[model samples]
Target chain A: MTGERTVGERTIGEQVVGEQVAGGGSGTDDFYGRLRAYEGRAAVAGGEGRDAVNEPMIRHWCEAMGDTNPAYPASAPPTMLQVWTMGGLSGHTGGSIRSEAYDELLALLDGAGCTSVVATDCEQEYLRPLRPGDRVTFDAVIESVSPRKTTKLGSGHFVTTRMDIRAGGELVGKHRFRILKYAPARRSSAAKERTTEVKEARRPRPVINRDNAGFWAGVAEHRLLIQRCTDCGTLRFPWLPGCGACGCLEWETVEASGAGTVFSYVVMHHPPFPAFDPPYAVGLIELAEGVRMISNITGVPYDKVRIGMPVELEFLRVDADLELPVFRGAVA
Target chain B: MTVRVGDELPPLRIPITRTLIVSGAIASRDYQDVHHDAEAAKEKGSPDIFMNILTTNGLVGRYITDHFGPHVRLQKVAIRLGAPNYPGDEMVLTGQVTAVTDGTAEVSVTGRNGIGNHVMGKVTLRLSLDFPHGEADSPQRGAR
Candidate 1:
């Protein structure tokens, strides 16, 4: 009860404030020591940003995530999009955060008396589309920090970071992430406390039948190609084995004009994918060939992409040999 | 008989479910726990949700495209998401045929979540309309 104490007699707040005010009282700055320790102990996690949109990675990311939307015409086995975007697609792939960084961050939070940490929200805005064959530099910066209160978990701090993804001297995407950390709640003496581990769920490989073999193959080559049914002459995308309308098995592989108009779109304030930062727009675009492609609309402010707006395609590499196709409003 | 301007287009019922949600997520490469994990979602801040807006839009667009047939090209679709759509919620995609010309038609579309409008927007179609009007069918050869 002497200084700022939350848990019984262990006063971390008092210690922190005391150290800050005392200046030179404590033996060697524990803040720096603690920071170094955290750097060594925190969990390392990262998100992937494309220098230029790589179509193969976009398709692979979707495939890994088991996306079956007809808009993405990639050919590949479904993996996990969240993991891929979170810089987890490869054990040690490109543009991923070192796990040591997570360990360090956790250590820092723990020293601050925060025991439980979880990713709460994410938002990303694309300035330019990511493409294949472009070497991109990933820059992650802590944007803001705030303390929050939760009924179930007492009190904690929220850390937000703005990740600026750049490729070829152009800003490709701006990723914003919010992480929540809480102090283990101190309950009544008589009540037994319940604690559980927050685990990242595992995803299984998507079952790829003959329906989408060609699409996946094109992804390996960083291509955004679709199938035009030889029978009905209808251009169908997201690669089904046969035509959706005519049920024709025979088809010709055609490249997308990659040009479309935004039919409509909605800005997502919530994180729908574990790998994604939130505040994005899921858009429906009617391609030049009369096919519709569903993708995340990037490069413009979420509120600015309007109905009947022109857009162009950009490829993203989800991982090696895998690509994803996303879209942006075509600038007039 | 042609649909009158402002006449309500026939309401199309779309089954909102988890599978569709997953499909849309996969297509857009947005696989978050809140979308696929029921328990994880409850832990976050959801009431056992169903589909994300991307999937919802996909369904709505599919409904119109299916109705319009292959020849009529879909020119545009503009929509907005209002309420959270849970699985099993009957999504009644309703619209009004706002405009129809000799070679095209425009429809205002909306997805209702029973309680209220979940998604609202518009769609435009450019029709070949069999053949171009007032133009001769034969290609004119260069004058000798």
Candidate 2:
């Protein structure tokens, strides 16, 4: 709570509890340790639907859902599988089908301070439609427990449960439900004021060793350099010490023409990463000297980067000490 | 990911929320107004914002890998959307193995929401190390 300050929704406090958790690392293992025990076990068993599918109830449900479709016959909506068993507005607080294990599980999570819960999603498959006045029976089992996930509300675990619904003792539908049980995160009051002192995220350091040092040194000088096998005239874009074709350790550097054409390209769009902007183009550029290398493509819309598009090499200053060779689209 | 006929992956349940639908749509780079804007969605014939296909695709990938571990790579996910998954609905995903080769498996998958089948599809998974040998050496199919 030290140095905590708050003005609005924003806040700045002390250092983050564990930054690794934000990066999806296993920093909150204890929270999940108590969760994994219930996986694949029966959460509720021998559950019987309170009411069989009937006409008046169907009309009520259809009216509530604003559904006006008429098919002459009465078939309950597949989504209504759970509706038949729900305690409804009054809520079914306790019952035989409600497993002690389920109660204990909620207690365990509550004990860990994750008292709030919100349903995240569900999936259902229907094998048969419910006719008027068909009794529904069901059973449910704990399916899986995900590790701690950071959501807007806070950090918590997602628990999934699966239910099998049957009509007249015949399998009809399967329902899977997931919920995030979490405690609301306490925002740091000092967070807004401390943001100015925050540094830029450091780029992942390149693995530089004796074999690749000189190539980076050349990049530092804004030169596009390629390695050539002295013995066989073989050229490679990636600066490898030895030639694969001739088994020669002796190699020399050659200054490239800094011109190339796109051989193949990919427009990344999903799963935004920290270090790079998505929907950007990355191209495998085949150089004029005939070796291909991958680099960031610039000066063209990510969608418009075509095969055989011309490009010219340019140096991009990535940070304080790192420079990278990037290719810019040449004017048509 | 290696599979034969009749293999079943464990079920995965998901509870739909405004945040889950919105974040999943964003992660998949889907910027449709209906996916994130509730008011816009209501105007466009939906009672509320619903989950998009890309989020369903990503969740399918998660379900497949969760069953097969991290080594199995999903090569293709072809799904057709059915009923919309509105917020406050629960989705259950189930899968059955249809075919298998040395290092690959093809699975038939279905994700069902409260209303009905949200997405039905076939997934092709390639297990990188299922065997020592890689895929077929030659592109040509030699006729007997």
Candidate 3:
């Protein structure tokens, strides 16, 4: 299955180069020379993402990550920089635009017994936020390839690729990904034991700035304060500086009535952080004052925290230094 | 509020689960066998399916906005990975304000897992200056 998929993804130009390189037995100098030749060459040109920036994928990503920020529904998370350039399971179709140099580079590494590959890291700069319905196009280049180096993973070469993602012909973001293709090293028992050591982690502290300092102070006082626009009477939950309705900079704090319903919610089941238990429910609670805030929904099983369920505001003491506003839901 | 160079952003802890690995991979349109198919990953010399770079990027972006609020605009996020994020592991992401000028702030961020530092990088973001500053409930016009 892997062999078939690999061949199917390669371009005709690459297959020809693969055959040429396969017959030649080269020394280390020749191998390094050949590898260096591919640097600065285009790896992919005019590649298109299988799908445009859309809501479903964004929603799926947010659900998996337990992120409920309101800004995401309209604009995509900036870190999804490479999703638009992926070829997926079937690989790039409709005549691969992948450069022959890239194929030969990987084939050379595979022939040298550096068959295993792992993504080391990536860097992204967002020029603009991607919105739904934007068709993404990208071009990638072999940014660099490092000389052989020995590490815990064994001896291998590092390959870095840079991609520029565009929407409507306008550059939107740049992504640089580095991967190590290496031969697996034998694991020592002592090294294996170190992986099992667990460290205690605290719940992430909420970002407190001038705009939201008042909200945290309210939480400290066990009061749920909603920001009310003094001029327009519009209420906002996140405590923004200005009113979205009247553009009013004047606002006052109105203590929430404490009655609310679950507007939307997600059950977190994976990537358990140290401070949180698995399968817990995080909800978007709609206060009776008609504004929504994201918080943990307690007092019920994660599965039973349904939308529209009544919930009351309460402060949760996550640690000695932190007290968060969470909601209590009744079991149906 | 005025952002100082030494301001520290809150830390966030993320769980590493098989479901998150698979979901994140698919969500990012990365169908690499090593990212979702454990058997395929074993064939490639990995212990199990691992998180993809796109997912890490998404998480980092979320961590930034979660603190700076929804109005914060991300300008750049350049990160380097040191350790792999595998299932049954936890990653704690921490950040500090390194520089601030003309409504733009540069932050240094680090995400550490059990094995070691998983990611390290810098993020440049532009903060909206229109928000009312000082005395949370009082109106201040054109206050810097």
Candidate 4:
């Protein structure tokens, strides 16, 4: 997959990870390498300007990321949706240069002799809600570069990239990503310190029970559904045994518009659980029915989804019995 | 139409202190001294080294957990970062209930640096709608 680049006649939805000849270029060893690199980034960046995110792309992202939120109104994750906007961040060029931007960046930093590169920190500020069918423009810049530090990965550099996500000149989100590039540390103090401070894994493993069986089924169908208490007329999520108010034991499922607003959230630099990636976002979204559910936010660019902004839901299939639910703003 | 869509939670203000930053760092496994070592941060060109983005995000998640109690399960949170907040910079964490269903709810979350928005994001939580609290009523163990 690294050398060939001609847009082969591979059928749609086919998982192709090999090499293909590109346009009329001689398959020189080094030439093909550079060309593949160039083609890779170009495809990722895509053609810039309006219409950056299309329905098919969104669906593909949602499927790959296993994000399920109603905002996608599909079985996908909002976080994966942000990748579409990142493509626009490459600018409005349909040329191979624009496509090669992300890879080039990786190659540039890698070529710069940074030992081991890893993501140390990330902060995504959602300025506005990102909705499906919205064309967004984005620009990313290297905001800062920190000196190398000793760690298990060795001495590394911290590079921060700031991406401003926008749609029709309106600010959507501000995403700041901090990447660490380091070499193996030889028993350095920094390595010991980081190792000592490592957080114990605590994954959020909600059990799959009968109460939530229906909700999981909805996910299989790409639907967002909730349950309500029949006795106290209360609403619940993750399908529970009793009412939150009247202590009622009976409940019924309800399908929602999957819209809500930011009640509160935090940026977690630590990995509370092994399943969760570091620099993760944890938040509480208040539904219109006076209910609050804990879920991850995804879809829109990091900088575009913000507090008090509107959002919707999307469901991601984690397994046959479990589906992860993610959220994004309903309107951007 | 008198139909329920989502519900709002009580607003909360969290003190953005050195301790808060420390707890988040510990929870996130982020050992950057800038988050804990004020002196080291100053040496690194930071104005007293503010909380890491990971800590900021964890705080947001904690806010929801605190309000909803332990019965509710957090599914996802999408947040962003803004101006660097030092130990002294207080943050106002807020939320809004935008949509609701029988068992699930969606909320938007925001964290501000005293003056303006420092972190903006959203979350979706799941809970038992029938009972006053879900079967899992016990609060989760505090982050180590």
Tens digit per residue, CA lDDT, model 1, B15-107: 667765665555544556667788766554455645654455445555565555544555544444445567777778877765666555667
**lDDT of the structure predicted as candidate 2:** 0.68
- Candidate 1: regions farther than 4 A off: A1-93, A96-332, B1-4, B131-144
> How is the predicted docking of candidate 1 categorized under the CAPRI scheme?
incorrect
Each model's number of backbone clashes?
Answer: 52, 22, 6, 123
Model 1: per-residue lDDT, tens digit, A1-332? 01211112111222122212113635324543434343223233333432234566556444433334444433111111122234322333554364556545656778766766544433434343344455555556554445334423335555655555555666655555556576645555312211111123222233567777667677667667878889999888677777889898899988877888998788888534444545777899888887887887778878778889998888766444346677878544
Residue A327, candidate 2: alpha-carbon lDDT: 93
Superposed Cα deviation of residue A181, candidate 2 (Å): 0.9
The fraction of reference interface contacts (C-alpha pairs within 8 A across chains A and B) present in each candidate is 0.00, 0.00, 0.65, 0.03
TM-score of each: 0.34, 0.37, 0.61, 0.33
A85-186, model 4: which lDDT tens digit per residue?
Answer: 432323434544233465565565466455344444444545445565567766666555543333433444455566666777787666556666544444
Write one digit per residue (lDDT tens) for candidate 2, span B1-144: 334556788888888888888866553334667889997774333568988654675567567766776555555455555567899999899998766666667677877888777767666666657533223431221320
Evaluate candidate 1 by giving its C-alpha RMSD to the native, one decimal: 30.6
Rate residue A59 of model 1 by lDDT: 61
Candidate of highest TM-score: 3
DockQ of each: 0.01, 0.01, 0.24, 0.02
lDDT of 4 at A9: 22
RMSD of each: 30.6, 28.1, 25.8, 30.0
Please give the distance, in angstroms, between residue A332's alpha carbon in candidate 1 and its true position after superposition: 76
As a whole number from 0 to 100, the lDDT of residue B24 in candidate 4 is: 52
A305 in model 4: Cα distance from truth in Å? 60
